[model samples]
Target: MTPDDQPFRPISVFTDIAIEARDIVRGDAHQEIPGVRVEEHQARGVRVTEVEIFEESAERLMGKPRGHYITLDVPTFKERDPELRQRLTGMLTDQLKTVIPQDPQKSILVVGLGNWNATPDALGPRVVDRILVTRHLNQIVPEDLRDRMRAVAAVAPGVLGTTGIETLDMIRGIVDQTRPDVVVAIDALAARNLDRLLGSVQIADTGIHPGSGVGNRRQGLTETSLGVPVIAIGVCTVVQSISIAQEAVQLLVEELAEDVTLYKILREMTPAEQRGLVEEVLGSRFQDLMVTPKEIDVLIDDMADVLAEALNRALQPQLDRQEWT
Candidate 1:
């Protein structure tokens, strides 16, 4: 069928990664964006990008609230490389330290946000299991070591589908009781590109929208919503199926461009038109489909361990490197 005869309908790609949404429209990450600042750094085997969106205009453009986003791109984070894993964990720890408050007496609550039943969505609960909770341990540890420990607590409130309660509400109840100095949330995220899935970790001061990647938009776990600062850490674990298909269409268009008739017809369609055509071809059944890697089982475990270690190291800087305590 000619590109002209295809019916057009607008479609939107859902992504929880701050950089993915911004880069889509900005064309280049290095280019100046109004009300937004972009900085890039590389260390060891990881590539780090910091994007700060402080202006309302930029917030509207990026579809993210005014906050700081730090993304670590480590292609092998999901792989079994002990030395590299240690380095990445340290890097994640360093990045996390910058946002957390400097108060020595500070207490923190770490909320893992996802359904434990689902592996792709299980990243949160899995990481929570490994976090070092010192809130109750300070009394038991030797008196000399007590001062180095920070009160830490973690919970993995099952998703609404399972618990019949809002994740935010459950968290709110906990926050009211504990009144921690800060909150850290971990969840799986969706990315526009499959390459980023399980490869990038995004740390944001903007909190997080549970299930946003899957169109389940739950209440955001943010400062305004919970009355405490929230830090969200997520790894891209899925991609919208439509995003992959749309990119495939673009590649096909380029491949077939030598044919003048086809080239003329296809070139006339705007990017949105191409996306619409892709959406139509996808139909309703595939509209809600989200794709994840085949090796997600192993990947999630590897990543969860590293991230849990990073959280432990960051929240308790004085802990021995070899010990999570």
Candidate 2:
């Protein structure tokens, strides 16, 4: 059958899925989960949830040693709210700073987890790109202004490259060379749903898997494997195609482009126009297979900046408290 002979395609929309606190695994006394009163929901196809299990919420939590493990559900570039994103960043930063160890001479190893070439899985690389990497600062800035930061290095392990090094091996080598205080890993994650494209960022004290984005799970990067404490931060960037279809429908409900607004405009459209504009734009091509417009690049940049800031803030206190005590 010819293209025009095909019937009008039906659009699919995705919505939030919900979860309760009782269903999630709880951390041990020493391995506690922070920000409890846990709840779960879905956005797009990404799982959205919140928890508050910190042992010391208002007291030494900020001053004492601790770790942060978090995950965020951000569904779309077009849908992200700047204010909400910043607020989440700030909360994660505050919690992480409270738990990180303080020591000026101590070092930190950061791993950017995920494949860089894929846009949906590039959150890890994008975050590391914006970091104030301490190791490189000495070459660019005067020694006096370098602050108390002892050392910092960022790495992204290629999944199939000839490098042939495992995530654990790379981190172990860094730990052996630097003997740093801690390690922080940033990675992209799969949510049960698809809505969390850019609206959330999660931070956790536990370890991480390097190539979880593409479903290649090797040995995980955690404290036990490297003999060093590990903290993980992640954002859910991909979701189900059904959710994408839903978002497109919502967009049409509120606004219409001048060219496509008129049923008359649509009436006059040729087969080529229908296929190029309405059918494609409102179909899976816009939602699933492609990255849509160029503005999404900006959204990724913003997410990277927010994550980097949160990581830096979490580490700043350790930089400050290093020599004092």
Candidate 3:
């Protein structure tokens, strides 16, 4: 594509860090960013894509930098296949272990970041409910038996609307009191593509800025801010309505490209221009809207179970996979 044909600005709509990185690495936009690396792997039926941003320069280009983003692209996270579930959980746990500092006995605090009352945003709280917290057990059990379990703590800090407190502030207080070695934060993310919604999970070593999915960015939870390593895990639960419309418009453009009369007019317009036209037609009211599947309730529950099982297995290495069930 020519310079005019290429999008002039980075698509600011997507919230999933991996998707943003993929767009850059694919030369879709910002091809000048340096020190970006990408690798792909497969585990059974799962497709794993790793995108590493190694420098601040690339970070400026992609909007997220200096972190390792691992994306698990599963066809459907709600599948009933036991073997597929086992493989997916194993893959997720393995990714979590890599980011977490090596200390099987270390104290970990898993912060579930979301509003439990909303199904689309309830992935974090649900996962927190399913986690096998051993902090209390460690205090009561003898040292011999306690060694079998890790000191893991979990909390579902509700959104600012319900609690009237910054989620970061509450987490900071808990971090100071519990003094955990690491923190694992989970939340639901927004995707630019409908295909990725409820079909992918992203894990990052660089912390997370909660509420970014819906454009309400809050103070980020990071090692620099919290004084401990922060691993963020999230699944894309929704996509912006404007983005969906843009995709549909692009498909229509492609289908009409072959027409002799439309070819010249369409060829003169860039993808960005086409998207602008679509947005103009959609109007401002629909631009701010977000879209999620009607079955988001069921999807969130299944994802929470999968993520919780993975976290439990990774935190407590001594426990067998079957023990999670």
Q: For residues 1-325, what per-residue lDDT tens digits would candidate 1 score against the true structure?
A: 6855433211246788877767764642346567878889899889999989988877877678999999999876656788988888889999999998756589999999998999999999999999988798877898767877788999999999999999999999999998999999999998888778888999999999998877889999999999999999999998888888888877777888777677667767866678778778784767688899889999999999989988888898876766564
Q: Give the alpha carbon lDDT tens digit for every residue of 1-325 in model 2.
A: 7854433221112211111111212211223234334556554344445544455441122221233333445444355666666666666676566556656556787778766786666778888776656776656755555565556777776444445777678778878887767888877654433445555566656577654433455687778888888877776655545334544543554465444656446545543344346445555444334222245467766778777877776665544433322
For model 1, the run of ten residues with the poorest summed lDDT: 3-12
lDDT of 3 by residue, 21-80 (tens): 457334445554456788888877889988888876667656674888999988665555
Instruction: Give the root-mean-square deviation of each candidate in angstroms.
Output: 4.8, 13.2, 3.0
For each candidate, what is the lDDT? 0.85, 0.56, 0.82
Candidate 3, superposed: residue stretches over 4 Å from native: 1-11, 21-32, 78-82, 259-264, 321-325
TM-score of each: 0.89, 0.58, 0.90
Task: Return the TM-score for candidate 2, rounded to 2 decimals.
Answer: 0.58
Per-residue lDDT, model 2, residue 51, is: 48
Clash pairs (backbone) in predicted model 3? none
Worst-scoring 10-residue span by lDDT in model 3:
24-33
| CA shift of 323, model 3, Å | 5.5
